[model samples]
Target: MQETLEFPDLLRLIDERSTAFLAAVAAAPSLDAMVPTCPEWTLFDLVEHMGTGRRSWAATVAAGPRATAKVEAEGAPAVPREREALLAWMAESTRQLLDALREAGPDRGCWVWWGDSQSPATCGAVARHQLQQFAVHTYDAQLTAGDPRPLTEDVALDGVEEFLVTCCATTSAWPHEPATIDYHATEGRSWRVRLSADGARIARLPATTTDEADATGTGTAGELVLAFYDRIPLDSLELAGDRLVFDRIVAWEPE
Candidate 1:
């Protein structure tokens, strides 16, 4: 299994790449490049979205048990008009957020709207949540800037699995079910994820063998990651048993 990371992992990756995104924002190709594996966003909007997400998480975490919703459908702050100024603003905004997250620390209490209503005091799960969000979006920004390689398989798979399990609560695109899916990597790693009306709950796989799933598929980790994001072709899956379940998986979307 890939070594798991705490919330600070994101703080680190964000610090390293935020500047990369800043330096290339204007020169970066038009926002039209769909985040390849991420699909729903253009590079421009993805960076803008993540930049705002940093603020949203900070605000929510700082607020403690009572977090409020303040969404601006427009997404992100307006650009400063001057290219250099915009980059600086973006760069500064990200760094400031990094500082805010650091000062608050993972132990600070938080009320998150997504995933297993959590307090930052017990923050390992929160780290997984924020890390995947930031990592995928960072990939989008990097892709827009013309560097398209994905994060390491373990990282991508973590995010991809997180997205799949959480899709029911986060979007109407998925057909919600109480059924569970146990994910296994050929490389001796597995995560058992359950999706239900309560949303997603993930746990480490049990050592004992369970019945074969209603359906199963196998492929490279990267391909599985893209499929989870609706970026890869579902038919590409190698399935055994109850193949129709695969169709439903293809239909899922966060929207």
Candidate 2:
């Protein structure tokens, strides 16, 4: 895994990216515009989802481990029809989330649904999770506005590592036979992922290694991260080795 980012740094990123996301929402010509990346969601729905998600996470950080019930009860708020009002609401939600995270501090114990029992449920994990959420949704907002920008290299690389370690490892089923794939990001970070009927395992590879693998994907860090999450098409990547192996790996849906 890539080195854990400091909690304060993660909060800073959340602030920056959340601003960008709301800006895109503001620039959107129509709230009814469908987000191509998330076909089921219109721009209005996306904004509400992002804002309410931040509020729910903020509540989780404040309540700590005892917050699970509260988190579940806090559903997303209804999307506002007026454009300016929606933008204001988004800004307020972001500010509230940042305040909650700062108050909780890095090591403060908190409930995180994604964290395994062995992993410490702390404010840091919530911050990291929110950072990735902001990054991805910002891209979604931009894409909807028809001027998608790639994530920064550092954030994309960390996101790739996070997805493998967290999402892939927890997937419970594999439709195809076991296989291994190597992901080499143009940013010079790489990881080895082993997928089987049992589950998936991931390891960060030494930068200089040249070992062969059953399948390999070469792409920019942002492309790799987006592709891994099925946010972008697989053809966007440069594939070598066994294409089927790579396909099967990506095809697995997390339980």
Candidate 3:
């Protein structure tokens, strides 16, 4: 992994991924189609979620940090007629966000809710969170459309790394009763996470889950993120050790 990566690069990567995800979603046939990972959410629901999510993030970054600002974008209307328009809107909104982040600079100071993460430059939480959301949502769209692609290990591992550190390691998002979690990616690639009770942690691990774990989960890193995010079912993972640990890890919020 590169040392001290600037947030602009992360934003660029996220922007590329956002495009990739939208393309996959466009590959889908119908909004009513069922997503394999998120059985309850239809393709329509996933598309709407992505659009609204982009709007919310764009608003958040623009607001310059606060205690959860209310997003102005109207909630998804009751009747969605043209899914294609919504998908295009998602793409353009994400592109605009990338532009904003580039202008925002990693070192640029700003207000934030977290104690140590008050700076937009250093506060890397929302970036990683949204990336994972796009990844899983893309996967969901792919599965729902009955067309799946091999998730890039480099990309998936990046997501796995960020999720472990930002979400599992710290309860900054939850702020109370925060338990940490660690993700270990097998397959002998570079990926793992160790989230503990003290401000949660993330780092590359030499091994995936094993008998030594409180619980173990085995799957592709992409699958792991999807499973963790509630987009995928529990049975999808091959588990061992303490299932509770794995379950607890997945139960955390997206923030």
Candidate topping lDDT: 2
**Better model by TM-score: candidate 2 vs candidate 3:** 2
> In candidate 3, how many Å is residue 248 off?
5.0
**Model 3 segments more than 4 A misplaced:** 1-6, 66-80, 109-123, 171-182, 187-212, 234-238, 247-255
lDDT of each: 0.56, 0.80, 0.59
TM-score of each: 0.70, 0.89, 0.72
Q: Weakest 10 consecutive residues, lDDT, candidate 3?
A: 114-123
Candidate 2 off by > 4 Å: 69-79, 115-120, 171-177
Q: How would you encode candidate 1's per-residue C-alpha lDDT over 1-255 as one tens digit per residue?
A: 235555667577656556555554565766555666555766556666666666666555545545545233234457554556656666766665666567677676555555332122333444456666655555556666776555666666666555544443332323555555655655455565455555445565655767656666666555566556554476665656665555655554433
lDDT measured at residue 96 in model 2 versus the true structure, 0 to 100: 79
Alpha carbon lDDT at 84, candidate 3:
72
Per-residue C-alpha lDDT of model 3 across residues 137-243, encoded as one tens digit per residue? 77777777777775667567666665555444443444334332334556554433444444444555454434243455677877676666766676777776656
lDDT of 3 at 205: 49
Top candidate (TM-score): 2
- Steric clash pairs (candidate 2): none
